[model samples]
Target: MQDEAFFDETEQLEEASSAPTDTAARKRAWRLRINYRFIVQHTPYILFLSGLALVYIANIHYTEKKIWDINRLDKEIRELKWDYISRKSDLMYNSKMSEVSDKVSGQGLKPLNTPPQKIEVEKK
Candidate 1:
């Protein structure tokens, strides 16, 4: 009789524990279904907004690169202009008619001994 009671008590305990496990499984399944439904409902909007953000970021990066290129070109242009002006000044300071004549002679062009007389034409 004592052994029969012990067996009955063990079976009751096992049934009680398995009942809670089944309840927990049902709760977890319900939560998963809710999460899936929420994601399915909002997926399109989420994807669209992500695409727009990516495009905006790409445009900003391209504009930044272009601005940097323009700044670099401006600096280079200023340096070239400065070099040109300095060289022009040096040429103006050093150039002379006699030196030009010497350079012309070196290039095989003979210098005229006398200035040519000018002729003026009147327009009617």
Candidate 2:
């Protein structure tokens, strides 16, 4: 009976020591296991989400570029408007009678001193 009891105790001790190793193996296998079935099942949804994300990023970049273009165009338009106003003012000043006479005086072009008279001929 004593030998039988000793054999049972030895068996229990060995099982207890081997249990930790078995649990460690199971943990390692669990970590390494890949659930390919689940991934395959959700592949369509994953691809759809990836495409949506790409589109969203592209839209953001496009919007930023459009805003930049609009700002640049607006600045260019303002500069062009200012240039037009300045040129128009210069033309207005140069087209005045006094300014024209002053410029032509140096070239010996004098202003007319007399008003023209109109003559009518009688039908004979």
Candidate 3:
């Protein structure tokens, strides 16, 4: 008897839904409706997830900035190292004995022409 009643209700519902206008009406009723209570209940969790996403994005940007900075510093260091080597080589060339003599020639300084004479003196 209970099953007959249930089946009767289902038959009526199916018959009502079979009409095109009824189906459209049912579709309209089934349209999504916002549940504000659900949103309010899970607001914190949603905010936390949003925050996590922002932090993840920020971390990637920070890492990329650090990488760029490191690469720039490396390039600068290499340039400075090359400059240092060039200046050191220039200094070494300028300090050679032959180079020193040539530079001092303009100042009336001359290189030794002969070996130094060692003089011996009698002790008093």
> lDDT: which candidate is best?
2
Model 1 lDDT tens row, 55-99: 999999999999999999999999999999999988976687777
Instruction: List runs of model 3 lying over 4 Å from the truth.
Output: 1-35, 114-124
Taking all chains together, the TM-score of candidate 1 against the true structure is 0.52
RMSD of each: 8.9, 7.1, 5.9
* Tens digit of per-residue lDDT, candidate 3, span 84-119: 999999999999999999999999998899989999
Better of 1 and 3 by TM-score: 3
Name every residue pair that clashes in candidate 1.
none
List of clashing residue pairs for candidate 2: none
**Candidate 1 structure lDDT:** 0.91
- Tell me the lDDT of model 2 at 110: 79
Report clashes for each candidate as comma-separated counts: 0, 0, 0
Q: Pick out the ten consecutive residues of candidate 1 with the lowest summed lDDT.
A: 93-102
Off by over 4 Å in 2: 1-35, 117-124
Candidate 1 segments whose C-alpha is farther than 4 A from its true place: 1-34, 97-124
